[model samples]
Target: MEFLDEIKAKFPNVLESVDGSNENESVLLLKDKTKIKRVCKEVKNHFDILFMLMAVDKPPKIFELNYVFSSYKTQNILTIRVNIERDKAVIDSISSLFESADWEERETYDLFGVEFIGHKNLKRILLPEDWPGRPLRKDFEVTDEVRNWTGLDLKF
Candidate 1:
């Protein structure tokens, strides 16, 4: 299934995206967050299903957001992605447009700590409310319970 042609036929400004196949798939890097929602809807409306959502932690600065969509109509799978900055880690919510995106967005926020600006139920999906730093972050530290493990600290 020529996924790019199908996408262009459905969404005019979705940007030029490449198709990946075989036993593996590469992320379709998007220009920005706005197209993320646009491409997602186009895929669903024209094709008819959602495959999955993924969030990759890009250390020291940002997170990469990915949405995988499949069409029962065309039997093709397409992955769309966007990079969200560390400082402004929020993106417009597609939950308003797609019901399934609700839980996926929450899961991303929960694990990677990226906020969805308009997500009504954007909250920790797999972590407690009071959890300290974002565990998935590359810079996030995993301190030993026994600080004296290295025998360098005398403070109790």
Candidate 2:
């Protein structure tokens, strides 16, 4: 709790809010996506491990990216959240700070179409390069070509 308060005091402009609930997991919402790398670097000073990075498509045009981190010394879990506009879903890449982020960012880009602006090799990791559209988007439709390929009579 004190750590979050300290972070809030230190980076008031970048940090939006701190969630105390959910078993004391500190969820930090970042107001500026451009400062994500710097903020994550600051967080790395306290949180040693990057547990996971993923993206979620909030319907009606919003994409939320979440980065989960944990501190081995204090056993604290911290989650950083950034909201991106669906039309221009671009955010700074943290792969440089955390090597594990390379694949995660690529996967998020592949499925959610959330581009990590500074990623070295930003490309599809799971789906093919020729994949029609981001499969994870709320409006993504299952085409007949895909259904026929998989031999499933998909209705939608």
Candidate 3:
């Protein structure tokens, strides 16, 4: 279940390889958006199961996408992460690699407003179509929230 070399050979420098935990663990941090699809494919080939997918919208300039995969053979946990830009926030869907990523990618897209370019069910999973902004992003703000909350400090 050692695919680190495979990853290295296929896509050099795409992964800033994370050292495994003292226990049987594998983790890799991704640095480029374009390389995520290849990494996802490698992970699925090696692991067979994608345990989870999540995204975090860090402020100002970047977002982080995280994936947790489990190898059915070796029973190891592997983490993959990629940092993306705020404006050009798009990545390939992992549905081609792992079928389980369908719902997870939808959830991440709905919540974080990231575009999974090839997802079949890329639609709102948690929010309605009318939802104003990507709530999880640190810069997201409701336009009238302060007025709605404090009611203009009426003196009546």
Candidate 4:
């Protein structure tokens, strides 16, 4: 698809680096988390759907967010990854561009403690609002409160 070449030509400032060597999918690393919305808006036409939004807690400093996009017509997958500071794990929400990103973003927020700055309704989806901490984070500690909340405190 020459996707990287097109992106470089059209939106030179959006990507920091790209790995287009894979035939099945292309991976792009954004230079800044704040530019995510801009990039999504530009590429929304090429990718019909935001297939998934996932987060990875890289201990000691970073939280990587992967925004996977798919095109039904072209059967192509493109992933845009952005890394934010672990302590300040916040990023612009792409829900405005893709409907599917709404729930996916909320799920990531619920589990990873990421703040989707412009999400219309950013709230806990899977876990309750009163939940102790973000369970998916690498630094999360399993305390009695958390264990009891999940009924993990029950003895077998």
- Per-model C-alpha RMSD: 5.6, 4.4, 5.0, 3.3
Task: Give the range where candidate 4 is weakest over 10 consecutive residues by summed lDDT.
Answer: 15-24
Model 3 root mean square deviation, Cα atoms: 5.0
> Clashes per prediction?
0, 0, 0, 0
What is the per-residue lDDT of model 1 for residues 1-156, given as tens digits with 9 covering 90 to 100? 455666666656645555554323434557757666677666566545555778887777777877776656556666777778887788888787767788998888887778887889878888667666677777777776423244344666
Q: What is the TM-score of each candidate against the true structure?
A: 0.75, 0.88, 0.81, 0.89
The lDDT of each candidate is 0.69, 0.85, 0.78, 0.85
lDDT of 2 by residue, 106-152 (tens): 99999988888879999999976876788889998898876556434
Candidate 3, residues 46-152: lDDT per residue as tens digits? 78788789788777788888898887878878788888888888888888778889889888888788999988878988776656667777786767863255424
- Model 4 TM-score on a 0 to 1 scale: 0.89
Error of 3 at 84 (Å): 0.3
lDDT of 3: 0.78
User: Model 1 TM-score?
Assistant: 0.75
Stretches of candidate 4 exceeding 4 Å from the true structure: 13-20, 150-156
Q: In candidate 1, which residue pairs clash? A: none
